[model samples]
Target: MNVVHILAALSEPTRLTAIHIIWDGGEHCVCELMERLNATQSRMSRHMGVLKAAGLVVDRRDAQWVRYRRNPDLPQSAACIVDAVIAATDVAGEVAA
Candidate 1:
């Protein structure tokens, strides 16, 4: 994945948080994300779409809902950037709390 695309995808607060949540090493359904992020189904789906397009995440169809997880095929360099972004935001979140 292109570094610029990954960074751009994470630029939005909602999308950033979505990635943070999804990065927990488990697939996340859109409904779960919607509740956690206090977002509408449509809103969450749209944000996930952006992440998907950026190759930051991959999705699977699960009946009525779409589930997402960090792209396992992400290049090592791209993974490093994602790690940094998550770490930075994780710290920021802790401080804010």
Candidate 2:
């Protein structure tokens, strides 16, 4: 986990927006992300790709619905920082399995 890379990704405005949405909304599907960000699937996918690569998020597929949520098992200072922000503002209260 490159801490610099993770910070770089989250520091982007669009990705920060996505993170706030996901952090508040709990797990979200691709459609939810699109609607929330007012972004195309390709755009959202690109942002999600960055987050995933940063080890800051995780996705679980239930049927055809892929739910994206904050990653709890990532070993990085960046993950800790993101988790702190999320926890401080975590309206989700609890992360779903």
Q: Highest lDDT: which candidate?
A: 1
Per-model TM-score, in order, reads: 0.90, 0.72
For every model shown, the clashing-pair count is: 0, 0
Q: For residues 3-95, could you state the per-residue lDDT of candidate 1 as single tens digits?
A: 898999888888888998888879999999998888999999999999999988999999999999989998889888988998877634642
lDDT of 2 by residue, 1-97 (tens): 8877877777666677778777653788978888866788888889899998888889898786567987777776765777666556433332211
**Model 1 weakest 10-residue run by lDDT:** 88-97
lDDT of 2 at 32: 87
Q: Which ten residues in a row have the lowest lDDT in candidate 2?
A: 88-97
- lDDT (C-alpha) at residue 21 in model 2: 73
